[model samples]
Target: MKLNIQQETAQDFNAVFELNKLAFGQENEPKLVELLRKSSAFIPELSLVAWFQNQIVGHILFTKIKIVNNENDTESLALAPMAVLPEFQQKGIGGQLVNSGIEEAKELGYKSIIVLGHEHYYPKFGFEPAEKWNIKSPYDVPANVFMALELTPNGLENTSGLVVYPKEFDTV
Candidate 1:
């Protein structure tokens, strides 16, 4: 099965939402995607859809997130709310979406990326615990689930703080 990952547009929006809903078995993710779309943190190209036969079958959103330390300077970007349609779950579409996001971030000169996700799945893309860099998430997620990847060396060097997701995420 061939898959194409592309920048999402207005026409693809509803299909992406429905894909997330089916993948997660709830309406929650669909709503979260809507909220993120309106949030100031939304990164246009980073919001991607995976297409199979031109139908959106997976969705991944990379919104601007912040890590504020004692100094209060904000270091940004954390990946979240990634989902794939139930029928597409075991395929490598999810990995392609994530890799595509990382490439976009790199080209845009983003220093680091953080993710709160399955330990096994994320590490395949080189994510290690954010704690290794003294970065943290405000919520009590498993230590293993809160992970970070430096697109450049010392991306979080000497940066210690909490990951603050955008306000849209607070709606969940």
Candidate 2:
């Protein structure tokens, strides 16, 4: 497949919304995407979509988040609601979105990323338990499912704190 990964544009909003809704079989994720787009956390450069033969097949988003401790607060990135059309699920479209998103985040100077997702799937991208860095998700979820990745060397070293997500995420 000749796949293209690119930053999402204003014109792609509806298609990306529908793609998220269809991929997850629910409206929550699509709603989250819409809310994130309007929130300060949204990173336009990290909002990416995968295309094949001119049709959008997958989408991924990275947004601003913070890790706060007694001493200081650190800026970080959060990956959420990654989705691919059901027909395109196993064809590596999601993986392509993730890989491309990571590269874009690195270029944009983000140091770390947090995600609540499949334990098996994320590890391939070098995501490990967030607890390894003493980071905790605001939502109560299995430790293994809430993971983090360092975009730079020692990016997360000694960082320990509570993750603060955008208000929009609380709805989902």
Identify the leading candidate in terms of TM-score: 2
Report the C-alpha lDDT of model 2 over 48-155, residue by residue, as the tens digit. Answer: 988898899889999999999999999999999899999888988888889999999999998999999999999999999999989998888999999999999999
TM-score of 1: 0.96
Write one digit per residue (lDDT tens) for candidate 1, span 4-121: 8889999988788888888888988789889888989888988988888868888898888888877875656778789988877888989999999999988888888989889999
For model 1, what is the error of residue 137's alpha carbon versus the real structure, in angstroms, after optimal superposition? 1.0
> Which stretches in model 2 have alpha-carbon errors above 4 Å?
none
Candidate 1: residue pairs that collide: none
What Cα-based lDDT does every candidate model obtain?
Answer: 0.86, 0.93
